[model samples]
Target: MKATREAYGEALLDLGRLSDQVVALDADLSKSTKTSLFAKEFPERFFDVGIAEQNMIGIAAGLSLAGFVPFASTFAIFASGRAWEQIRNTVAYPSLNVKVCASHAGITVGEDGASHQSVEDIGLMSIIPNMTVLVPSDPIETKSIINWAFKYKGPVYVRLGRMGVPDLLPKDYSFDTKPYIFKKGKKIVIFATGIMLWKCLEAIELLKAYDIEPTLVNIPCLKPFPEKEIIEIVREHDMVFTAEEHSIIGGLGSMVASTLSRSYPMKVSFIGINDKFGTSGKPNDLLSFYGLDAAGIRDKLLDNIK
Candidate 1:
């Protein structure tokens, strides 16, 4: 098991080796965000902005303008909340090649309380024009997405969790904006993102005993959502359920619901944090408490179907 943030740190190191133009900036959270790994190897190229997220973003924007591919690392709350204006005006407005890869996003940032946990980072970043939002399911996919972000010239926000999760994708899996079909079933379709994908997979197994089969789709890309594929997939199922470690209001659930409501118009249920702040606790315990665990998901599905 590995955390996506770990993959991000390794990816940054690999990127640094591939291109000298690649630079990293952190808001005094290098150790937590794992950007310290990159800082160790490339001290000159790495800048620790010291808790000043807004200034860190401005520096990154300046680096981008100077023909450098700057990757800014920080906690999700500070990246999306504290430095949102700087990101919107400086980097995203100009559509610069600045990648803001935030770690410890969503309820998974357990024991940190609501202030540190970011449940609306995706929605906030997605609202900005030219800002690409991505959430990788596992470590392998995170590396792949980081590679893609480097190749794509624009502002990007990649959400990564703090907890170590089981790998769901194959070792050789490459990053693609399209949704990945983990399993094919007819009655219902479950769309999941981030760490919720693992829980959804476990829920599918438990569903087998109840003779309830559902298709599982892992949505790695949140913004520039795969609408065409989602519409096609929903056409084959009776209902759709979106699961994410975010608020149901404007995260993955809202994106999927909006797409289906416009084109498909099917019964869509959302499994996520329902307009509530996260509290301090063990990550696994928090997931279970909020009905985001495997058993919890299975029970919710059974209730909705029946």
Candidate 2:
């Protein structure tokens, strides 16, 4: 239940039960993205568009126009890049209700390296018009947000991690897509997403050891990055650090800083890739190599706090 695949699988079943209008399309990634649950339960509602990611989105758009709520699934890169034009014109431009469900996002898709990895997917989707991008922190939150996308209008890009993520949400917890503050603090705010939540947890422990009780905000929904909530948190804390396992250019770090500067100004530091392509290393090795681990965050915190 803690793995993202389980949440996607369970939530698709829940969505299928809740709405007769719900239909799914996948580009030969049924097993990977867990859309097979829906495919099995409602074969008629499921469309396996073969390995055609572009056709997948285009068909999903057609389904939307036909009054069916289409949730498209594939690896992040192909969904965003392979079918980006179709998504932009057919879905986003028209403001259609389509959920682009993506998996194996970020460096978490280790060993596969940069080729299969999708470090830029979040930035790519969030920039599109009428797109509500989501990067859920854990399995429970993944379910909550995917359920949110079900009821949410317009186009949505859901970026899901491939690895087994720790459950950061309380059992029987509720989530509002606007903004849900997992932990609050006075000095520093840790705004983290996907794969990097575990790092934030470790940083929290290290910070507590150093008497720096920081706030940890597990930001799954990155596109509509809780604008008001972020500004308030920034004002409440001495400083805020945006952390994610992505390049700082257009990832969570960049998104947070952009929101803060316009809505509310706050001292912010970014903790992520120093604008580089990730190498084919062990996950832990990659994290340490890019200074995105617990110790990396701790060091960045110390540097900025003083």
The numbered model that scores best in lDDT is: 1
Candidate 2 per-residue lDDT, tens place, 1-306, comes to 265766887798889989999999998889889999999999999999999988899899999999999989998889988889899999999999999988877776777787877778888888887888887778887888888888888999988877787787896766676555667777778888876777878887888877998888877777766888778767877778888877788988888888888978776788887777767877677777778788988889988887
Residues 96-179, model 1: lDDT tens digits: 899999999988889988899899898999999999999999998999999999999899999999999887899899888999
- In candidate 2 the C-alpha lDDT for residue 304 amounts to 88
Clashing pairs in 1: none
- TM-score, candidate 2, is 0.94
Q: Candidate 2: how large is its RMSD?
A: 1.8
lDDT of each: 0.93, 0.83
TM-score of each: 0.99, 0.94
What is the Å distance of residue 196 in model 2 from its true position? Answer: 2.3
